[model samples]
Target chain A: MPRFSSNHLETLLTAVDTGSFEAAARALSITPSAVSQRIRAMEALAGQVLLQRAAPIRPTTAGETVLRLARQVRLLDEEASRALDGSGAAVPSLPIAANADSLATWFLDALVEVRREADVVFDLHREDQARTAALLRDGTVLAAVTAERRPVQGCVAVPLGIDRYRAVASPAFVDRHLPGATSGRDVLARLDAVPLVDFDRDDDLQQGFLRRVVGHAPRSPRHFVPSSADFARAVELGLGWGLLPESQALEPLAAGRLVELAPGRVADVVLWWQHWNLRSTLLDAVTAAVRRVAAEHLRPSPV
Target chain B: MPRFSSNHLETLLTAVDTGSFEAAARALSITPSAVSQRIRAMEALAGQVLLQRAAPIRPTTAGETVLRLARQVRLLDEEASRALDGSGAAVPSLPIAANADSLATWFLDALVEVRREADVVFDLHREDQARTAALLRDGTVLAAVTAERRPVQGCVAVPLGIDRYRAVASPAFVDRHLPGATSGRDVLARLDAVPLVDFDRDDDLQQGFLRRVVGHAPRSPRHFVPSSADFARAVELGLGWGLLPESQALEPLAAGRLVELAPGRVADVVLWWQHWNLRSTLLDAVTAAVRRVAAEHLRPSPV
Candidate 1:
């Protein structure tokens, strides 16, 4: 007999998917005791603690390896069911991680196209671009739009494009805070003293951009707007200056709502499509849509 | 000597605020060893570990108690500096937690108004409506906009008003999925069969609405659009039917882009303003602005 059962792997997936043993049992149409038993059986067979039984259950490092195996099994199982029935009855849930800016601007457009003909659901895990690939490694997501160039152990990285961000502020904000500062040199000198907007405390883009302009990330009054749209809106509303993606900034810049602080200096973040190494039809469709739509919106990220 | 020193408390806040001992040293113009020694000294004085020595350091439960004390001391010290200098050079950074929707709609308006007068910066922590108060409990944020009506251990809750949500979908979506299903009964009967949008798996608004309309949360293909504005936009693009806050739904509904699925059935989420019960002038100003602006946009939550 094999050490792992397909049923137990699925139970582990369901438990993590629904976030609790009870919810997983309800989802799988099994008793909570059965869910616990399957998990325990898998742990006993593996000889390691595979899960952290907390408020919302989390898979341990050892469990992550099992989870990757389980996801591949589930994908194959769903593909087989579709092949057998051709009814589009079993919907595949694709878990993908993405940065907030991409999600707001162009990522959903790909999913929209996928949902047009495909019978599928999506679980989008929002993380910073730098950390999105960790989700892929942890088996939390099958794919990710990340800044990571190298692939995870069981994943392949495909270059999406460069997402360029420029330092911009509302017309009124420039008038008030950065008065008489127009050119790159003028702006860089005054940039540290003026207020700015950040996505959150950990959002180092603004600070990073400032440091590139000046020597150090000097003290500045910052407003933390956590939402992508609202972060742009806060800058548009003259709250402070911020670095916005070209996708979000172009139209507003054309409309005379925003002005560039420095003309030539722009931060370019190269994003990549990292997905599990799989031969499933669902993964192919998602990757195709993501690549096609991303090409339309993003600049060339040539090596 | 008092058990705690203001310098030690500030060090703790700086360490947590900068998210690293190395970064805190850079910010405070101190050596990394000195930073470690300060944290160790605080831990020895308090008889417990104050900060987790890891990436993006977090405070333990005992550390939270010290964090709150540190924050209070910092607030008082800043207030004193401003009072003495009368120059507004010592700008205070107020950390506040809020739901995504409120941040997207009326919450930022209050911040904009506050910025027009005060010279303070803001750090906004985004959490779900159910979990925001946890930030206050853990001393991560000084204030919060929460659905939690009961005050945390050392906080006060004031009614912020109600955010009303209604089931809505783009007209094209309804035309495609719920064809000729005009009445509430018609839509509710087939709602479970149609694809839906959720903020995330943790978002139970749509499921709760479905359970009220039907018997159970019947399986439906779901799209997780996590951003506050993007979630509304996804529904507008006809990806899936979703519950939209009236503030977001009103214009689209008026413009005939979106149609109400269940006209009279609405989800009313009451919001409350919770802040640390402190005598500082900054908290008073923030609470006043939050109350004043929230009054303009939200419905009466009289109780």
Candidate 2:
């Protein structure tokens, strides 16, 4: 087995992180030729090509194995440095993935609390709930808030709690787009014809709920507002009716600015916190903070 | 010369848009075999492969030529349909790319105004200011709000306005991380050592300004908060000092919730509106609305 030496692994990480050899060299304070040489030496030992050499570099299958090993080594190294220094400022930033809605609503509070006690830094990648685990697989992030219940290969999963959503529209939007309906079933049938707002193309929360409501996703026109805050605001501006998370939907509902389109109906996304199965004290601190804050904000997970 | 037929072109567009032959078939109400056959026939006529057999479909160089043609045809067809039917609802959604800050602040107002006049819909893509133009090149978005002053090929660029940003920190953040400075130079001198908050790794506004201030990007610890509204909120919550656009920073600055880190110094991003050079009335409406709203919010571009 060809072991990846730490110096060569550092070069590999910088190359992929920056996307090109020349750029990586600038970041690592080395020449592009040196970066190319280091990568070539590693490839020769491994007997396989590591990078695709594309504009934004991508790792080959063999490279992924080495990348994971490199990341593990890096984490252990950082943990060791923190232990030695004791000042805690030498800790490297921990990369994590989170869904946009959670990041917008409550995840930062956990990070802020963590920062208050530890001199730590973070690199957050905003990803879809369905896709965040891929970051963990690629060794791009150490932790994720994801919808996937099955733990990624070497990670442990914990239930964060349910993020409940309800179909809502501005009072003016309800007056304009949806027909008045008295019964719950009547509203369900009418949902197939009205305009809706989606967080993005992959945002099937509205569509999935409509499918459960009317047996198929609607052919209705949609306005894709890719940001979580903007998606709620789009509904408030009467662009279209949308599913707003309970945290965002509640206040406006009470204020009478937004009205529920479907009474007694809500969409619940059961979010999970998944992190590397590692034993660093700093990682444990983050995990604890995330659990504490999530408990405070979210409803209990269903059995 | 192989000219693409309208039906075959529609198949191409659907396949690329949906990202797989099976998904395209589902979307177009056809069988996957039929979708594959149509693309094969088109490829045979062109004497070249059009699509990359990736999990999510990708276009080859020759396919980009065809993709551009298909988009132009689709826009024209929708325009003709609206004219002949005399009903504005036949129009399809327009995909547009914008940076998070603009989308969170001023962009949606333009979209709401555009929605009021036409029954047209939108598909928004949230991208970094530096990369929005690439969305226009790939046919993923018909238009973009980008920092690129030069127009993409086949697109026209118009000045939106200059978005000015200032480095700000919550009062508590300053009290902890920064030295009380007597002069502008002293503040600049101390800024290199403090913790900072970034929108993401590629957010260079803070780094770029720091480089100009003291001649290089800082090695300070950073917290990456990806959302625009939340990035500003993270700064206000005393996470770290960050650059905030004038629109988001002013009220908090006046209210003493946030304090300016670098007084009288601001980073200005000159924004441009770029769209396909097509004469569609709907595209014209979006272009006009964007210009009108941007003028209302942003500072004038430098001469």
- TM-score, per-candidate, Cα-based: 0.96, 0.95
Any runs in candidate 2 off by more than 4 Å, and if so which?
A: A1-3, A45-47, A86-91, B1-3, B45-47, B86-91
Clashing pairs in 2: none
Q: Per model, state how many residue pairs clash.
A: 0, 0
Q: In candidate 1, how many Å is residue B78 off?
A: 2.2
- Write candidate 2's Cα lDDT for A1-303 as tens digits: 697789899889889888899999998899999999999999999999998999899989888777877776777787788778775545567888999899889998999899888777788888997678788887888899988889999999999899999888898876766556666676668776777888876777888898888887577777889888888899999998889988899999999999888878988899999998887777899999999999988999884
Worst 10 residues of 1 chain B by lDDT: B84-93
- Write one digit per residue (lDDT tens) for candidate 1, span A1-303: 236999999999989988899999999899999999999999999998899999799999999899988988887887788778875557667889999899889999998888787777787888896677678887888999988899999899999999999999998888878788757789889898888898976578888888878887668877788889999998898888999999999999999999988988999999999999999888999999999999999998786
The candidate maximizing DockQ is 2
Candidate lDDT (C-alpha), each: 0.88, 0.86
